[model samples]
Target: MDIIVTIFSTIIDQLQKPTLAFLIGGMLLASLGSKLEVPEPVYKFIVMLLLLKVGLGAGISVRDANLTELLVPAAGAAIVGVLIVLLGSRTLARWKGVSKIDGLATAGLFGAVSASTLAAGMAVLDDENIAYEGFIGALYPFMDIAALVTAIVMAKVSVARRASNAEIAADGTMAMNAAPKTEPAQIEGLEKGLVKTILVDTFRSPAISALLIGLAIGIFAAPDSVYDSFYEPLFRGLLSILMLIMGMEAWARLSELRKVAHAYILYGIAAPLVHGMLGFGVGLIAHHLTGFSAGGVVLLSIMAASSSDISGPPTMRGALPEANPSAYVGTSTGLGTPVAILSIPLFMALAAAFIG
Candidate 1:
């Protein structure tokens, strides 16, 4: 019993640490709409720095990590990404009764991994002195792309299916709400082009580009003085500043969140836990099967818990413009990421309990 208390206490103590406190403080101030602001360019720079640090850290550690051993977790990350979209979208549309487009959009937002959330998870791992394989950071792109592609494709399919079922009117024309009648060739060409464009854009995204570059550097390059100066000396300080900025951005949507339906709001809070537990469960299984460490399992769980606030909304907007941005953005940024941040320690605790 004492040991259990000690474990939770340690987790709580970590959450309350001063660095995370800036996140809390930023939220408080931003929710009030205070004048304090992180300039747009400065925020971008900070984000870039954090992402590079993560990549570099992964790079350094990855040399010692057996690339072949990462296959299970990497595959698991992709599977979990798809699951989050499928399950999350269905639950929203069927259970909460949101419109199909809105439900699918929300699913995409949650289904995708949040880069900021990943950054926070890394910070937590650093704070706890937990050691995980550097290649784990490489898993970010797999989850990110999977979630975005799943959401976009599923949303398109749902719209098409609904259109196909529409009854023909007495005048021998399609129903107004049905997809506009078009030649099969035109439709096929349009769909093909759109899908190609989305695929291209998703891959070309800046975050994905940065992550890939970092992975290449980490994997191919030998250790150098630059690694120590860039990643070790400066990572956390920049990350703290980044968290403060994210806190502001998140709370900026406070009003939008207040307007969400109670059912949707509950989904926002609960979905992360469900996804997080699922992620952690997979990580645990992989650990046993593949000999992955506890810290790696915990890190995977954290990745699963996050939503794709950065890349998700824009992609959903382009693909499903009819979907409500308020629901997806408010739910992802306002409720989901914050919850993921808070839940990461609990996940770490779970990993420790199971793997220790």
Candidate 2:
């Protein structure tokens, strides 16, 4: 259809060139071991801008976020994403016979949702005049909940497996504080190494902080412009830091990805495609039931694959070095990363034109 082609063209314009540039730039920087780093505050600043943008965009669309009507499709997408993360990650981990830690890591990693990527999607959708609601921002928080839950579940599974195998010996028992060891079933209650790190990072990261802040602002203020004067410099700085950091992060990953190129290709590409299709279907059905737009549907699907590029897999790797972390992490990112960029523009155009 003409609409599809046009949407593809727009996505191509945004993605094809940008992704290539990202790869090339990442390669050069990574190869050179370029010290080009995003300062801590700068990273925070960028997140603030993105969060503000997401909040403003989402806030303006609140009128469209009717629970009585819109909940069906939104819930559908969530269900699909949950199934995909739960079943998909478990399937891959089991078939691969990856280490228990690796399996759990993959589950937690895959379950998480990425707000930045979704923000990019929102940007693309806006250009296309799509009619998606701002509550879309909630996807990030929702995914975090999933990631948190999955993390606990996976950790418990790993603990159980290790216990059965007698891997968590006397020495290991001492290392984990001996308290939770008396009963490994307390995964949900006691914090472990990986989950602890994730929780710390989740709160410590300014980006997450800013998103929560933005949500609060949106809730309190009518037109977001009312508080615009406060975070002026922070917002302006966010865009540049985000762009440059994106390149830097891509480069960093590309360096490590060389070893497991094949796996990355499969996981990254496959994960998003599966999620995207689910999202599209959810959007379509939502529309049929409550007249949600096609654009909204597409955006929902694209968002399913969102998660931290550096955090999830690295957390897995650090937590369980024995699982050949590269296979799961590299493959997931390699395929997901580039496609993620394109998904933003493509889904935005789809959701905006039809749903907006």
Top candidate on TM-score is 1
lDDT of the structure predicted as candidate 1: 0.77
On residues 209-321, what C-alpha lDDT tens digit does candidate 2 reach at each position?
66666666566567555545554334334543464566566556554556643444455666666666666677677788887666567667766755555345544554455
TM-score of model 1 (CA atoms): 0.89
Each prediction's RMSD to truth: 3.1, 6.0
TM-score of 2: 0.72
RMSD (Cα, Å) of model 2: 6.0
Backbone clashes in candidate 2 total: 17
lDDT of 1 by residue, 1-356 (tens): 75577568766887686556767778988877789877888877776766776776677677787766778888889898889888977688666547777777888778788877888777788777898777788888777778778887777776665555543343355556344553333446547766677777776666666666777787788645776867667777887787787688778765686666666788888999999998998898889888888888888888888888666777777778888888889888888888888887788777777787
Clashes of each: 1, 17
lDDT of 2 at 227: 44
The whole-model C-alpha lDDT of candidate 2 against the native structure comes to 0.58
Q: Pick the candidate with the highest lDDT.
A: 1
